[model samples]
Target: MRPINEIIVHCTATPEGRPVSVAEIDAWHRARGWSGIGYHRVIDITGARLAGRPLSAVGAHCAGHNTGTIGVVYVGGLAADGRTPKDTRTPAQRRALAAELMELRDRFNIRKISGHNEYAAKACPSFDASAEYDHLFEGRERLFKPIVDHLLQRGDAGQFAQSWRDQLITWRENRNQPSPLLSSQDPDDLFGHAVEAETLAFQRERQIVADGVVGPQTRNEMRLALNGRPPFSALENYQR
Candidate 1:
């Protein structure tokens, strides 16, 4: 794993109460010719923790400061008008964000927690993340294992399954290749035939083993597809 020392927070810049999926963000970044989503993690309106770029890779969220930093984004920053910046974090989002920051701080021994506004001339994140989370750096116990570690396959249900399905659906939409199977499914929490078929299709497209199961390799490839490959040359410069 790459050494990490900082966590930078950002906002999706979407209007309040608007739901933004991790895949949608990835598609946006990809439209800019980037590999995928710039942040490493995303917190949705319902406080769902969505994965973005892998922790081992450098993020594209910050210019000239991507190295050794993990990028985290919450789903909303814009007010109802969608023009002005605001602290639109829901109560659940606030709790979730604090928990996530504490976990990362302990897990990575992070030294800093900052907002995008601190680094650029933008009102991203819409709040003082550094000041809010300054106490996280005091000290804490670390977790020995990652938060989630289970292969998503047919018959699985709940938040993780739903999150992955959301990502798959968004990716297909972004590619302008909508999946009829996925479209017909409601609730989107169950890993049924539609999800399995789409998973198989994605694996084939990525040229990985088409097992139709979301294992470690498949998950990594999904992230790679979203973020593109790591810029080794740029990382080398940052390291030096």
Candidate 2:
């Protein structure tokens, strides 16, 4: 393995919840007249890590820091409307990113890590990765929290919220866990009392804050437990 000095984190700058892959990035880079994908690795929203440029070769991610720095980009940096910069990482992405960073640090003895914004005036990552991951050097286990897109609660009905509730139900059922929130016959998407109860129970079981709200932490933990499978692959596939 090539000796690396710094690890730079970046974002794909796509809309929130958008799914991107290394192949797509490779084509984009090729269009830009670069060899291929600039980053060494790209982590999709579902937490799937895809290999990009070879680690043995120099990176083209940063302007001046390519020689000794490895670039890692996560999909999704834009807000819901897909224009504004935002920290749009999902729970799965958070865990996978933390793990990948830790692995890189250990494997390469990397001492410095920063977001793409730290070097350039642009907000590529759209979050302070250095400060957010500062706990890693202090032996912190899990460093960052999930990026909450919305809060799912009683009477708050929407396709996104409903999809989250449905995901919660699917994750619970798949794990062979019984939840009153789920219907015995079919999957339900309503955010009802049972959903709140199950959400609290899930949170408590995972030692998360039992606030009964599908906030960042709760969403993160749930997706982590679910093993970060693509929550809506069908929709994503259809879009593709």
Candidate 3:
């Protein structure tokens, strides 16, 4: 309701295998003479996402940036020794967190997602979240047409079928050294050998067949690799 724009992840800093609940977190905050839990949500060891503070109110999780952001706190962040900071998220928690974040992005039009360590030095989440999950923030769309549609059945020369070539070039180039020029110059058609080679290389990198054809399989693999970003409205068309 406060025009949420960012989703921040945090850790409870508790030791691995320890069980903590939202009720306990609420009591902790109440003891401090504040509202209930500071975060909008809490994820437990088994990856159960629970509600905490209401979305209608400003959160108390992050120090200075709580006004326009949502906070998600996982139960564990410490190592087995219970002192050293470590990413102790379980596999279930990882999946649950991704799903929860996706839902939040769709509902609140979230633009950016980051870990607590990005804003503070304490390594609250104990991992480089932004770098690791960068692909998830890239808005990747599935190709509506098959790659073979653009290729000439008899010869290698053909018009391109994909309009996402520009986006693909941008995405792939950002991952590696700048090519000075993109392999695909035409946004609407495949017109260059460099583009074909680049497509082949991308297929190889994704472990798919290196046929240099951007077909359904290639498009699916690309979508998976990109993981997509928040909805377009979340960043550009957001009314707030």
Candidate 4:
């Protein structure tokens, strides 16, 4: 599969309540001397997801950043006047968009979700999609703050270590992975060798640095794993 790392959201720019089909979009793009519908996916007023350009082909939606990106467009972005930009997404469309984005993110390990306005001067999506979907890329960072702050390791023994162990156990159990703590060992507040070994295994599985220490990235990955989401990509320098 081609490497995909970003999802860009757009709108049809049609008036509110007007329905536009993917075939119509395809004809429109063809008239403009393009292949077909530029977006990878389209959502209509009824919140139905329609296939557009095949994902194997690079999208033609964005001007310069088509490669390694998927374009998703919702049906309407205009007010009743059909000129002014507005967020015309209905409740169903909102839910559908969120579900689509989450599925795409997990499938492709997408690094960023952006609105068309983020790249251009016009308000194509008519809303702040990036800010609205920010939580989709985040982990339970606040819940893992204690482990992150203390940097738990083998020699550590405290409530924080115990909390980490508890979370790790939950993560393992959720995935049906064998628990690292021995059966004879009590659930104590200690980060022992077994914990360290398990930490290394988890880090390796998540594609994180296998340092056997609970740092910020490790904790974030752990939280995401426990929540049934994949870890973030290692492209730390990615802008968004």
Give the best candidate by lDDT.
Answer: 4
- Compose the digit string of candidate 1's lDDT tens values, residues 1-240: 867778889999999999998778877886653446778888999998777877787676875566668899999999999999999999999999988888888788787777889888999999988778877765432332212224789999999899888878876887888877777356669888889999998877875557788865567667766665532221222211
Tell me which residue pairs clash in candidate 4.
none
What TM-score, computed on C-alpha atoms, does each candidate reach? 0.59, 0.57, 0.56, 0.58
Which structure is stronger by TM-score: 1 or 3? 1
lDDT for each residue of candidate 2 in 1-240, tens digit (9 for 90 to 100): 655767889998999987887778877775654546778877898998777776665566776566667899999999989889999998999999999898888887677778899888998899999899967745422442221134667766667666777776777788787556576477565677877877777766665446677753456566767885432111122122
Give each model's whole-structure lDDT.
Answer: 0.77, 0.73, 0.67, 0.78
For every candidate in turn, the CA RMSD to the true structure comes to 16.9, 19.6, 17.6, 16.4
* Predicted candidate 4 versus true structure: per-residue lDDT over 1-240, tens digit per residue: 666778889999999999998878877875663445678888899999777877766566876567667899999999999999999999999999999999998887776788989888999999999899978967522332110123678999988988888777777778777585633246878889988888888888886557798865577677778888865532222221
Model 3 regions lying over 4 Å from their true place: 139-240
Lowest-sum lDDT 10-residue window in model 1: 231-240
Give the worst 10-residue stretch by lDDT in candidate 3: 231-240
Predicted model with the maximum TM-score? 1
RMSD from true fold, candidate 1? 16.9
98, model 1: CA deviation in Å? 0.6
